[model samples]
Target chain A: MSRHATAEQLSSYVDGELVGPRLRLVETHLVECQDCRRRLDGLQRVVAGLHRLEPLAPPPVLGQDLARRVRLEPKPRDLLERLEEHLRSTPLQSTVGFTFALVFALAVILYLFSGWVERQVLLHQPVLVAPSEVGAGAAVRRVGPRSFHAEDGRWLEVGVDPRGAAVVAVDDGVVRQLLVFEPELEPLLDEGVPVVLAMEDPAGGPGRVLEILPTPPEP
Target chain B: MEAAESTAAALAQSDLDLVERHRYGDPAAFEEVYRRYGEMVYSLCHRLSGDPDLAADLTQEAFLRIFRHVGKFRGGSSLKTWVYRVALNHCRSRLARRRLFWRSLAEPDEPGPEAVDPGRSPEDRAIAHDEGRRLTRALAAVPVAYREAVVLFDLQGLSYEEIARVLGVRLGTVRSRLARGRERLRQILEEGEPLAPESSP
Candidate 1:
């Protein structure tokens, strides 16, 4: 043990961590004593030596990796991330809106092309009312004869002649569905013509677009 | 304090203002804080870890961590203490992860801190480099408990309270550790070098 002060107290005194009177006492004692003075000098020298310690550069890759991670891993995910991800794969996906748009566009195009095809084909032949008339008994919705309904929805495209009805110049589902409805226009439905339709949602508002397709030509 | 304009008190606000600016989408403020503490952090890390490469990594890691989690740095300690804590803890983790644990007492480092002042002429820097090596050896030889207290109190110049807070220890413990560390270091340095502890009164 030292006479003047403990080694730790002297260390505290040098560090300025020792409080007012205690720090003063340590300083005063150090001043009077040669040995304590020498110890102080030694400690100071040690610290001075440490002050010489040079700064090392981190491994080169550490800096590069940290910078890369900072840039790449910038944003932390918000709470809603899981929900947003889940919604992407659902049937109510954003692409559904796009697909409906495609379907609606195809339907209108088919509607227009059907009219054009009708004008082209029906130009030569007359609008022949079939001899065996399937007469309506009474009430009738006076929509146009050339009409369509999407398989995805109950949406209907009204106003087209079902008898010699020409669909999009798509011979697939459109033709198959038409064959079930009107066997007479089945041949016309077989030739697919990429076209659009007017989508009439019966449970709701004014008709919007359905989709695009080409149906078969009427024989 | 109401009457006193304490710089230490303002330091937390300064950190918040800078952190707010940094966190609320201003990167320049972050740079400001980095510039402010860069050298201090480097010095602290360098002292804590004997390896310059590790120190630099830790230094950068400290700032980078601050950058990453600056938003979460609640207004508790002044920015200086907070930063020191972060840097120190990170170095500790690195040491722990490496398992380069202090063996009973700390082992004397075979090598020392890296010297980057390549611009200095050999003669100009040799004395300082030698001192640095001696200190590093002495530090490495010290018990880890004392080593940290000595480094923080003596070299980096943090207060006992600050060291206490940073090390999560009592003030008494800080004092005791610092004293023991200095005593150990004093012996290591003055070995037959015409220095000795005076006889106690």
Candidate 2:
């Protein structure tokens, strides 16, 4: 009680932040100590002077520019960044949130990879036309890779030969006919659309195309 | 008091909602936050940096940091305190990097932008303005640690608890800083010292 009140005690006392024995000690000391009382008074006036300095208005353009910048800022795109933000805001524990995020990223990767593989397989495999074995005029439908069947119990297999030529072979009970189209038709055949061909020789020949219809002839 | 309490309650309720909206890409969310705290932030930056232009730039940077990381706000502290913390940290780091921390105040004779108020008569206003300017210079002379405590508690009217949270320090630290800051400010003002001697860190 005989010692002068420290600057911290005086400051906290002015703000009512000091409590317990320290607060009482300061209060009692100030009553007996004229110099401490004057020092306390000086601190109070300084605080009061600071209060009188009103807050400054920021330059007007700051808000407009900041809003524009905030609007233009791209949303967080990194998956890990998004996950980190999620983990912060979520109620879940850090371990659980991290595990959840990892599992989600893995699932997304797996799904995308599977879709990519499926697309690759489909692009590489030759298309099939599945039509019942009937006759030459029957509508040809893709049945399996590189082959088609007619309603008259005949089989027609289509492919591009190693020489880069379009070849179609039709087989019934005994006779087999191979029809080859010009190389120009090879790219079009890859499009997986139905094609109708009119053979110049009914038996078979290379580079024979009297007519080519993209769609099956109507009934 | 009642009105202030209710306002505080409403702000508290909306703080998380605003964070949610910002996270969900609500364009207005950032604007709303800026509208609410823009001046407060600018004021703090200005007082700390003592440069209007630098404060303006720092204000923009601080808000951008807040907006970018708003999703990380988890209602742990009131949005206002969180904002003060973010803005203060930015100001400190930037000022530190530029070696502007502990920079002496502007020439004592130069009138500050805030020197005049149209509402007051010329004679009284001049006297008040000079006092205000002197106080500002004295404040600028104080070290950054104590200066921030004084500015937030006295100038900005933050409670000790709020100041503590904004400062990310303990309550005892806040008490000591405010006392020491006020004592330093008083010494500089009374002795008319151009700048408080920077204590060796």
Candidate 3:
């Protein structure tokens, strides 16, 4: 009240927005303050001028034009058109567009990431071949008279020439290669038994099996 | 107050019924809406845009919009407020695009032609014409935000609450804008020039 009523207070007072004590304070100030009273009068005059400006009637042809336009205009599908209009007019459109873009970007990123992971797996991947098949089949190529390498980097190191061939098993980065001559040892391999090979004598002879170890349980 | 509320509610219900009828292919329903709101729409658009020709075009556009989307009106707000919102939004967008809406009419390149009012005597008509022209120039000089509140409240005779609903602002904002708008308008009328725009607090 001592500040001659801030503009907000004066404005609110003019609009009857102030109530109770705020109203009373402005009323008291208005009665005693000539400057504030004059300012209030100016505001009142402007409001009066505004009210006096008569509302202009629409051009005589407005209704006719509107009717013609409406006739020409396509009728909107109720809920869908409403929603579309709302989205078009409001900030909601940008938000929806942004959300769609975000989803698309995320999907593309996930697809690319999955493809990259698959390629990496293919690059380092090693195929497991049964030793019985590799040692006796065309899949094994002779690197030397006694050594052969499987197409997938599994080495079949044959110490001596046996009636049967060598087979290898690799799992969890552990490699097990066996040179099997007897068909009975094939069951041991199938049963997940581990074996070591004994070297042949200096002269040509068949390699003898030294010890068979139990295969560890899979983790 | 309760009677007024009931009347408003009844009007809203009638508006909804009108929309439903229009959707159901009642030819007269839209015409009825236009008849009810045509002058109000035209007046609002004219006052805000300060051009009768533009107001006419905007009025047609607004009603066409209403005609097409009438089915979407659910009567959440009064039919009048919804119409005002749509009309005002269209004016805002179109005018902003042209960058011509906020130009001041304080200094006219040519004197506006006299407005013919058969209701008044010659002297009264001349005085009203001059006054109306001056008032229009002054109002146009006001900033758009304040101009909107003043036009809707004073020129259009909407209640403070209705203005808030139409402009989608708080009631307090409506009051503040009205006060500041009137103040700025008074300054322009007194000084006969466009005042520097004030940032709204």
Candidate 4:
């Protein structure tokens, strides 16, 4: 290996991923190269120091504050209602409507297929899936706009809007159960209890973890 | 302290119930949300934006956005994450609109609140704490991207996985950016040197 190992290689070495021949090569380089050795040592120190930066306590009133926001956040039922009204009144939209419909259809097909596949895989694979993917737009989503009840709590709506649809009971009345909409979850978890934002496998739906936030529960 | 803790405990149940009711269209729910997240959001904005007054404005705007979009929130992310996303997006947009110079100011430089100690010398403790502040300042010296990375990862103690989610980047990208971010932070804080220009997008 060249004495000038790239930053990636150095990072791998820091994480102890460099192996066998590469390991020995990096070792030899570090022994002879003071600069690389210094950087590695410095990083170790900095990381250690970072771990010690006093954990900030959210203002004592933080939990109440988080809960307040959760309660105050407005719902979009009216927007969905308006969309339904518009769609009903227009009967047909031009290119924009058609384009939205096309995109919407593709998304639904992809979501259903992916959701089915995910269910099968989760049953077989022991991987502990986290809720990060729910927010990751690029990830394979398991629901389509049509099937997935968005925030409006509407189950089905035309034109990518959430209106004119029946409500699917989300988790024993926990609509959108997968979202940690609770106000206390924030400060409570921030205190360090790892929170799992789980949606009730809306029977006939998928067990999706929307997000996980860890806040240590007050002792 | 005991009273506060007990009050926090008692408040938890009513709080959760109120949020659910609000989501169900209770207009009173908005008032509760405002009082609850108001300070915390303000504090986060204060620290991240380094301007308390500006943080207040951003916090108010953030709440408005949260209220408007709360209905769109699927139960896939933490309410914390959801609100945080709102606050962060607001901060990002605000930074985009502001002078580049203000963006780099790192929390307002006003001497932090005077330590409330009497017998023990506050100046001595403050001077020590100032080291931590210096670390924060060094972080501010970096560009917003690198600063956010460092704040989210190092200062905030987010897991690389979580940081990646927050920054919307691949895992490998998170690690590299963190490394570069930390390297830059270390240089500025320890070496008293300006950050070397980075080619990061």
Name the best candidate (by DockQ).
Answer: 2
* Candidate 2 chain A weakest lDDT stretch, 10 residues: A123-132
Better of 1 and 3 by lDDT: 3
Interface RMSD of each: 4.8, 5.6, 5.9, 7.5
Q: Which regions of candidate 2 deviate over 4 angstroms?
A: A18-24, A76-81, A84-219, B1-9, B106-122, B193-201
Query: Over the stretch B76-191, how does candidate 3's per-residue lDDT look in tens digits?
Result: 88888899999999889888888867445755332222335567677766555566777787878788998999889888889988999999999989988887888887777767
Tell me the interface RMSD of model 2, in angstroms: 5.6
* Cα misplacement distance, residue B2 of candidate 1 (Å): 9.4
Give the Cα error of residue B174 in candidate 3, in Å.
1.1
lDDT of 4 by residue, A1-219 (tens): 565655555656755767999889888888888888777665554544444334333343444554466566445465568577677887554688798987999999999999998676433321122233323332322332213322323232223322221223343334442332245455666676665443434223766554445633469
Chain A TM-scores of each predicted structure, in the order given, are 0.36, 0.43, 0.35, 0.32
Supply DockQ values for each candidate.
0.26, 0.38, 0.20, 0.07
User: What are the RMSD figures for all models against the true structure?
Assistant: 14.3, 11.0, 21.7, 26.8
As for candidate 1, its interface RMSD to one decimal place is 4.8
In terms of TM-score, which candidate is strongest?
2
Q: What does candidate 1's lDDT look like per residue over A142-189, in tens digits?
A: 223332333222222344433443232222212123222234433444
TM-score of each: 0.57, 0.65, 0.61, 0.49
Sorting all predicted structures by lDDT, with the top scorer first, yields 2, 3, 1, 4
Across residues A25-101, which tens digit of lDDT does each residue of candidate 3 receive? Answer: 99999999998887777676666666656667776777887777777776645566656777788764458778898
Select the stronger candidate by lDDT from 3 and 4: 3
Best by lDDT: 2
Winner on TM-score (1 vs 4): 1
